[model samples]
Target chain A: MSDLEEYKTVIGLSFGNQNSSISFTKDGKTECLANEEGDRQIPAIFSYQGSEEYHGVQAYGQLVRNSHNTILNFRDMLGKSSEDVTDKKHKRSAKPISVNGQPGFSVTVVDPETGAETTSKKTVYEFTVRHLNRLFESARDFLGKKLDGCVIAVPSDFSEKQIEMLSKASKEAGVPAMQFVKESAAQILALMYSDSALVDKFVVVADFGATRSEVSVASIKSGIITILSNEQDLHLGGEQLTEVLVNFFAKEFEKKHKINPLTNRRAIAKLHAQCEITKRILSNNTTASAAIDSLVDGIDFHSNINRLRFELAGSSIFNKMSDLVVKAVKKAGLETVDINEVILAGGASHSPKLTSLMWSVFPEQTVIRSSASSATPLAVNPAELAAVGAGVQASLIAEFDADEIAGSLTPDVVNAPHLTKPIGINEGDNFVVVFDIETALPAQKSIECVAPAEGGAYIPIYEGERSIKVTTVEADADESDFSEEEEPEEIRERVVTPGTLLATVNIADVAPKAKVEVILHLDAEGKLTVTARPKDGKGSNVRGSN
Target chain B: MSAGKSIPLFPSKTAIEASFVPHAKVSKPVVRSVEPIGPYFLAHARRLKYGRTFSEDER
Candidate 1:
């Protein structure tokens, strides 16, 4: 291989549903990059006030008044149709519209001079592109140079289509050379690099963010981390806790001023912001009081909530989180005793109540021959851990490029593939497993099957744990982009099917009972390659066909 | 203080016992892996991306 040149500037980005963070590697140390305001984590929000676009923290502030124009929670809507929206908050916050006949959001824009209002339809993909553009722009401003590449960390549950869309958006956003990684896997990389002694351990990662909670069981053996099982709750998140407080404060304000804060979007947004602060304050203190002046219709609102009251109000959300942890451990085919340590990620994990809940659920000791009693949450900065880990990955990727770029820094982390679903071949209506769930990637498996004389062998390969209702739609070529008004791409929903079809392989003109070897290899980037060959046939070997 | 400090999300002392009862059955794990770049997902992204190409700016 020829010597590859190093980049002038690159960054690692943790893209979350609610907030995102950026980090970079300098002199072998991963440092979280702050925005212009010197805040490490920036709100994943955008606001448009008559063509004046604001992003990050500024957009979050504008959301208080321009609730209709500000866009948040676009991350959760990726690869999902309007019908797929189950959360009431998302449904209420984002006005669903048709984009080219597909599900999209409507942004209400007002004319600056005429005071006329108009609406524009945009898909989640377009929204993501806008966000990515702003993120790259921020990084460029911070570094005083354009970014050459980036490694963005994403949720483990993002679908293949979603990942592809993100990659496409990165290219459109001017960051063409980019890589995507699972957030938990990135966190594990950061952990491994920080603690060299970490090996042969079964770690459960509980990543509780603003709008979702993810629990994953990962085992590290021989310098590689394999995700045993992953479970997530879309409904259970810090937003639920914030909603509890939002409602609580709203009701209190209503009782005093005879005005329902929830009735007004601006008031709700302001209360939501205050609730977030109260949630953080209640984390450390026994009681936290929230006071917002001119919160709703020029009325000041004050509400005091003790930890006990706050916990009771948000108990359902916590219950859902605990439920997810149990399911994750069960799916991993392990008991609580098997867990070495629970690694926490995201800002919500810092809540004392939530951390205590984690300890109670996964105690160090339970049954006979218990290895550990109470497996405490790993001590790490939960907010920036994933971003920092992504920086480490970018460094590792850089090292693989050239020895000059490595410059005396060698990350002791081995990138592992944590399969969300089993990759298998469909044979006679029965799924035959090739790569089992949680098997570390850069792994391969071979299967031998007899070829039929008449029809040969038709093998359908799929990647998914359970049967999913998939609707494949092609972009309508007849539709023109220059149309005055766009409809959510005229998508005709077809027959619902099960499983994602990775590829199909056909073995033709083979004698009956002829041995055919089928090998499937999952690469480091989670891409699969299939090779098929017949034992007695020459020039019939299919190499890396998929 | 620690014993009672924990919220009674589940009524029992052993929180896992009651909390383990899943309120909503998860048909699929929402946490999806990022699209593994066919090149990098194979453990060769950097080798394939930078190993061969020298950008004009870098040179």
Candidate 2:
């Protein structure tokens, strides 16, 4: 073990509620590792049949036959009490029950020797430990070395209690959890570090996963990334989209056999599994088919659906996702025009329909990095982005002391106070921002402005708030008279509200067209100092601090 | 002084201050760049050592 220490092997783990992935960094490049079954996106599932146990894709396969014994989608139940899990509709898997007031699932265990079946209860925490152990073992087997440690990418909405439970589970599994990076931050880090030209841009990371969708706006300035606003819809995700296809196919089967597959639990489970595959296929092709043998009443089911129909079927959910992105941008106190880039992450983000819809939501100039975009830095596989980012983070901190890493993750250090609104100067009726919001402490900016053409200028330094102004443009009366009536167009313009006047500087007797240099420095203690001087040395210099 | 006239002055030695409260500051993590590793580096090293280029697949 001591001899192997020189290698410093570490892995990044992106553990989601529906699926999880593991990644490793080699030669400063990160890659997701496939499990023994050649699956990079491993299902977060476990199953028991008699004396045998199944995991990953095998466990997913058991959902159809052993729906009562297969446990899946339990990652989100961690750290929740039994009463907190109000959703008792276990259509595809084991029913969650209370085990000592904690969330647990009831499964039947069969004894091989006696052929006896007995019921057993397993808490979510125990399953999490086993899941982590399996992931670490698979990673170790692939790397052929003992792991130094690992960084886990978690959702930004995870509470302190959930994070603590996850940390404890990792400890129980004997996998060192070096750090917990926010999934959005991890995705941005992977992109920023891979491409050096992504600095000083406002990025929106739309992570559409299987069970939930998370959208966050982040500002990356000088290599430091800060999340400006975050929005999450727990009920919206890939499963919802799959359900649309499942319903469509179920209707098609009903039309043929006069039987509804949704009436049977087993049939629904089978349709769900098949529809998930069909959905993934539709992401790559314009049309896809779903087939299931012995789907219902000893009948085989086969159907085909085109991408246009599938997208139309799922249009409501897609629109909701776009609305979520708009809400995130609005919450960040920004307009769509202010966003520089949108980085798509998570498995569900691979849908071409969703990618194209993003163009309508953001400005035409915004660069969206996805499989459908022709951007220079093409989107990394949305499924493996967070894991790759975690891997990169793991490699960076693998050699650091554990205590040092812990100290850096404390709330005080992570949530250090930053500027909530931008500080800028008022030029006539326009406000030109000099220092952006969320800038780290002790920052400075210098700008050279020309004095007014006719007289000296009064520069008022103020804190600015961003807002959107909407105006409606009526349709042309001649065009409407000849053609069908058209809906009025609403144009949204970004408006800045400069309310808080911080300071004002007056310069007298400045020559026309002369340059006046203004320097603003903000110290670590939040002290602001402004210095202005005329380049021609003809006007009076003014200096002030706040 | 007349109402239309203004006085021109030189740059002041003392700086003017404003009333603004600063939030408490905290230390941030120091992110260090890790040295590159893996097949590409190994191939480069082999080429330098043996005076021949080695394909990444050879590893």
Candidate 3:
């Protein structure tokens, strides 16, 4: 039998810090496989009630009643020593403990047969193994096959040790991890495969996750994807936004009931859970309400918040997210106008306010993909993009031999040196780039330019650096007398500063209104060559290399 | 065990045996054979062919 036919049951696994999902390609369509609870996005929590273990939504329910036994947010603690765990205060769930120099949790478990409860110290690696085993079992039961392998989606910032730990855990769970794909690259793959017209575009992936917000700038040329820059803020995420609502409602409850819900662990946990639902409702509606029965001191707390108020309360975080996107684009040495699309990933990207705020960051031509946007032919569920893309990737490589797969997927094969700054020509005051930054070595580009209508064309090629220029425009004077003190608007424009001149190709005596062909070639050894010749073939062709 | 004393969660013998079970009977074990590569390299290495159409039962 062929490898392709033998590997038909491979799946894609997106193992996130807050949630995880499994997807598989069946009948040429990649879709998420729901767990037994019918939830495609499964909570990454494990709870032990006595001798029985619960996962996903059932485990998530243990947060309120059995917080001491439920283990959540342990994914980030993997591969870290006890001293490496910076945030030791886990108020809502079980606190982390040190077990043999590694991060572990002490949970009380009851023996079903003997009816005796004992504290068990489980390492973070064990939880990862059990969670992955559950996901694998779900796929196995659904597909009715033993299994082939899987491609796992990982965040861009995951350290090598963390990845190694995850790989070991997966192996222990009896799941063969064929490859690990970056969440950003997986998101772009999902888009490109769905729409053939998405090639050769610059994309900004703004992933507003639960515990962190990550922004990656990727340039897709033909079928190759290059990540230009990545910026992440661990402090900004959905949890922070939920905290705002929690504080808002807590303040309201304190004003009426003369008690602070934040002081009580159970009350804070319940409020945090309900506020998350309220935040989701506010994403789709103008107003939403949060109600917690017996929240604290036998009092039911209820309050309503409109979308405008929610946006106002979280405007700082929203603006910071927008600024992170801009910073990522600037770090890529490109302007917002250069971005062809903005892909919203992660569960928190479902907010309409974030989508609208992103619209203000880029030009009107940029397509923002989110659940809030109007349905288009290429629209995909932002939350499921990474998993679906990983599924597609698994299907693509399932047929290759193990040796071929290992040989191709390596850093040495694709880590070729690339151009750091743009190499282009200065036309009057404007700089026209011929070869953009992040262009892999051994690349060549030919452009046609019109020579100045007189003497020889003195074309000087330069390496350019990008910077933002802020200009203030005065408010119009035709307004009413009451608005005389209106402040002038500041406009930020992307400007390129030409750096060291690489080479100059002097084509003397070009015909008037004639077109000149200029070719730029960059070799793998960082050598640059510029060749220019008149289109009419009646001028001195000059060539220079550096 | 005492309240604060740390003990191994599971037997080390069982853990070692569990890691050696062959999941893929048809293919060689790839988990321990290769090092993990960056996402960009993996994406570039698996670039799709131009004009390749995905059809049902293509595999």
Candidate 4:
């Protein structure tokens, strides 16, 4: 700790898709670190105006006039491949593009000297690296010295590759000692510091952000918090609700003026900005009015929408969210009665409808807790909760004894499976386990499987519990299987299983391969990868990328 | 600790102010670079509270 004391200029950062924040501890108190704008939360926005690149709130002001040059919400696309996003429609103002075979965005900017517009393609990774570099530089300037490293809070569902990318970006920013802090765990730490009563409780935590929502059930006992289950909807969040509002207002404007504002990019961008403001205003007021001057072709658009109308328009999304909550609770294997409290933490948690829905869902829980300060009567602004909590976690790491901080801030798993799914190899009538449940993480095992005598070996690897679906092969069942009485084909009536056929190991050779060694490796983050090799070493074998 | 020629890292008053002044004016008085309560001192003081013997690798 004496050597650790020499490098104490690290900051805690919460890099969000729509907004970002930083905080640091000084004189035994954690405070939100302000950006160049002197604001606690900076808009996670950036743009290239002429030849100069701008970031944070400064870039947000360029959205209206230079919408094409501004990039926002790139964080949501991180760790995704170009093909995964090619078919989906983007709702953001920035134009999504395949940048050199990667999922990225194209920004068209005018050259400052020539006054000619040119388009540049940037991957989400590149933008993120630039943003982090700028953030680190600002922190260094503010501290008036070099920093040790910073701790970043990330979504629970963020993949290992995404974390890897973030660390890579931090290194590009010249901050090399960075570590990840789970966002939910950081929030739990903040609560523990403020309130001691939460120690012995089963709490459901919901972090509703701009582009997605993650729900988890956590058990806290003796000041240690453990995540029981985590679930998320990647496509649902406050942005969806804002889209609903934008579409509603656009339709209303179109109906009266015989012109659709959505067709115009600038009009849609301006309307989006207004819709966001109206959405926040509607949270407190029964009715909110939206007006955009020269919204489309010199036509002014104005509409007054009430809370009921807004909620009704977004009811389907709300229902989907309710279903997600139910799914999460079911996965956690806990009934509503067993939940001791509901903890909502995020910018979108301020919505009355969301809060009321949680209350209705968990009626047994008398008090709904949030990341509010228990010492002070006033609630901690929901947007700053993750940042504040991350700041505390960083403080613990920097100053407290490693033993005391490690167990509380980082999860202490006892016999936790590396994969969420139960993995087994096919054995004639049933599947046999290479690694059993409660195997603790980062486990590896090899199983010898034989190839069929004549042809290629088809060794099936299955995940999750096996169940047989024996539908009687009755005559003329195709149309009957598509009965209106049953669920729509898209939504399967029953979960088909032999568990999931995760992979089928096969030899690509013309002849049969014998005595194949199928190796499975499960990493620390509960993710699996596979490698297969034949004992004879004559044929190519199939493998699964992690 | 040998005597050597010294040069200011921040030569201008404006540069010094920009380096030390926080983006937002905190309710607490801002610490000046010349003061004992600079960023280095403040962070150093906080680190001492844990009261642990440190290893070189721990740094």
What overall lDDT goes with each candidate model? 0.65, 0.77, 0.74, 0.64
Task: List, residue by residue over A365-412, the lDDT tens digit for candidate 1.
Answer: 421111111343344468788888888777666534444333212221
Model 4 pairs in collision: A1-B54, A2-B54, A418-A526
Better of 2 and 3 by lDDT: 2
> What C-alpha lDDT does candidate 4 achieve relative to the native structure?
0.64
Could you give the CAPRI-style class of model 4?
Answer: incorrect
Query: Considering every candidate listed, which one attains the maximal lDDT?
Result: 2
Q: Write the per-residue lDDT of candidate 4 for residues A171-195, one digit (tens) a residue.
A: 8878753457677766665555667
**Clashing residue pairs for model 2:** A27-B37, A545-B18
Q: Which of the predicted structures, 3 or 4, would earn the higher TM-score when compared with the native?
A: 3
DockQ of 1: 0.02
In model 4, which runs have C-alpha deviations exceeding 4 angstroms?
A1-7, A86-89, A109-118, A370-378, A399-546, B1-59
TM-score of chain A, cand. 4: 0.70
**Ranking according to lDDT, highest score first:** 2, 3, 1, 4
- Residue A509 accuracy (lDDT) in model 3: 62
Error of 1 at A409 (Å): 23
Instruction: Report the error of model 1 at residue A222, Å.
Output: 2.0
Tell me the fnat of candidate 1: 0.01
Q: Where in model 2 is the C-alpha error above 4 Å?
A: A1-7, A87-89, A196-198, A374-378, A424-432, A445-490, A495-520, A529-546, B1-59
Q: Of the pair 1 and 2, which is ahead by lDDT?
A: 2
Q: Residue A331: error of model 2 in Å?
A: 3.0
